[model samples]
Target: MKVKVNRHAAKALKKMLEEAGAEGKLFRVYVTSVHGDHAHYDLKLDTPTENDEVVKSDKEIDFILDKNDEYLDDIWIQFFHVPNEEWLITNPSKGGHHHHH
Candidate 1:
């Protein structure tokens, strides 16, 4: 899976990586029940030794999917501040935070 990281996201992620002295880890993207209907994702520093495929981005690292995550095909990750200091993961087709009924 490919994950795009903007300047803010890259800087933030780099800080965490530098602190741990770990590099070349993929930016894992997946769906969890946290958001319901595969809306939630946990993007953190994952080591290559732990995963099979690791994608290194110009600005960030992206993890290769074990299997195709069709829902994540167009997924984009960005960092936000005014809305609050957090990573904003979005699915252009699904919209935001609305639980599936």
Candidate 2:
């Protein structure tokens, strides 16, 4: 699996981790639920579980991905602050047909 975290997201996540006193923990990115061809994710600071794959990004962050999730390949995570503060995690390699409501 390939995961990329943009600069904004990386900065925000680092600050959050520091505030939460979660330094040194891996950034865990995993599927919380799946609907049809779409999946919802949960991000947290956690220790590595058995068989978990670690993906390093931004030279200072480590992302934990499930070794079994092939659908997460080529995923991009972004932090947005224009309309509102939010995290956008998407698979750009997939077909751009996600319906938002």
Candidate 3:
């Protein structure tokens, strides 16, 4: 798993992880659901995980995954604004997106 977290995303994630006492844990990224042509990603900060396929950015607290997500190699997560302003996650490789705005 090779997870890359953008700077902004990293900052946001760090706050959440630190509060949960998961600072050193690598953020685990996985596909938790799929609807039609889209795959929904789930994030977890697991401790001393035995999984070697997970990748985390040294500059941020987010992950890029290989654990059952090898097919999503080119998957990109982007945050966008909509409605009253919210972050949107997009997966170009999967050909669809789910708005969280």
Which prediction has the highest lDDT against the true structure? Answer: 2
Task: List, residue by residue over 48-90, the lDDT tens digit for candidate 2.
Answer: 8887888877546778888888656666778878888788777
For all predicted structures, in order, the TM-scores are 0.63, 0.82, 0.62
lDDT (Cα atoms) of all candidates against the true structure: 0.58, 0.73, 0.56
Give the lDDT ranking, best first. Answer: 2, 1, 3
Ranked by TM-score, top first:
2, 1, 3
TM-score of model number 1 = 0.63
Best by TM-score: 2
The stretch of ten residues in a row with the least summed lDDT in candidate 2 is: 92-101
- Clashing pairs in model 3? 1-53, 1-65, 1-66, 2-64, 3-63, 3-64
lDDT of 1 by residue, 1-101 (tens): 45566788778776766775466654566666444444766565555453344555656455554344555545566776765777777666656542211
Q: Candidate 3 versus the native: TM-score?
A: 0.62
Worst 10 residues of 3 by lDDT: 77-86
Of 2 and 3, which scores higher on lDDT? 2
